[model samples]
Target: MSQHAEQAAAFVLHSRPYRETSLLVDLFTLEHGRISVVARGARRSGSARRFTLQPFQALHVSWAGRHELKNLSQAEVPQVMAPLVGKALLCGLYANELLQRLLQPADPHPRLYLYYTYLIQELQQSADLEGALRTFERQLLENLGYGIGFSHCHPGCYYQYDTQQGMIEVTADRGCYTGTDLLAIAEDRYETVDVRRAAKRLMREALAPLLGVKPLKSRELFIKTRRTA
Candidate 1:
């Protein structure tokens, strides 16, 4: 692969201290998809790069490497995003974790990049956080080619979702969903509480296989926050 230095629009999905002063950052870039880079000396006090390497903001980043991990040469925010707080902050982290866990490295997903940018903005301002998250989850799965099917359900009738069998008309309540709710979720309409709750359940079911056995740390954080509150 080419090791030519390139600049791209990006966002920091996750980051952790590397060695002593450097940082290992996972970034989602518009042109390069998900990538990990070593931000040398980023943790040192007085390093200007440390301030610029933050999540929830649009960034212009440049890096160079032939291997999986690149060396981050420059990073700056192209635009500021409103800081997420409270539950929204946790929601943003959850989104980041989902991307980090599910997205393939070095594979560009321009559309999903746009969706993620919008998801952050929605989390910042949307009153319906659950709706926003469910929408993002659906789009993420679709982008990854694991799109859920909602067409098989009979209109106005109750149905159950089988992870392997798709939607099945329900004689008894097997899943926490109605045919109307499934259709609403398909159309991105979570107007009622019932629809939103069902959507969340469906999204969870859809995501389980891809996520495998390891639980998302971000999700665990959310659970703790809820229990405390």
Candidate 2:
């Protein structure tokens, strides 16, 4: 109705109550990447926001503002996904946290959005959570410009990734890990237990270059679950 109103396709990545009756919503929009908007009076008992804040549900939202926190004028689910079960839900939350932390505001990444949508479907149907997570992690890193190199040699040399300098070439004096090993990871050939473990390690090593030494809390929780089981 208002000239200032604009609609965008989005998903509720996260939401929290503001001062009293307002809510701050973290949204991932198809055209705007990640955005934080204020839904005034949406926290009231019978407010529309109460019904529209569910995560991972497709949404069409109308918001207007000039500041970082825009005003929400409309919100609703456009298409609901098949419900995520058990650890899949937690995995989704972990993915949301990663996006929130790694992505810069207002940067659109439609490819990554598609990848995330496919990942949700995969998680819903996956029998191998570790495999799915490892694959997703690799994809996320690659999309973020931290892609691992598993191909080619520098001139007359051949070498494997050092996990520090990316890739080095083979020489007469020093032996290096081969592109074969790195490619195996890129291709998700986790057939053997050893290879599967190696895939996990490679991903972790690759993530280290970008994410640094600090561990993700969600990943730590997932690890503890495995240790106790």
| Cα lDDT of model 2 by residue, 57-123, tens digit | 6788988977777888888776666767678877887787778877788888787787777677777
Looking at model 2, the pairs that clash are 158-170
Model 1 spans with C-alpha error above 4 angstroms:
1-3, 174-176
Q: What are the TM-scores, per candidate, against the unseen true structure? A: 0.94, 0.79
Model 2 stretches with alpha carbons more than 4 Å out: 1-3, 153-164, 169-178, 188-192, 224-229
After the best TM-score superposition of candidate 2, give how far the Cα of residue 193 lies from its true spot, in angstroms. Answer: 3.5
lDDT (10s digit) by residue, model 1, range 1-229: 6678978999999788999999999999999999999999999999987777777767899999889999998998767778899988999999999999999999898999998888888888956788888888999988999888888865668877677777767675655467888889999999998888889888898899999999999989989999999
Using lDDT, give the best candidate's number. Answer: 1
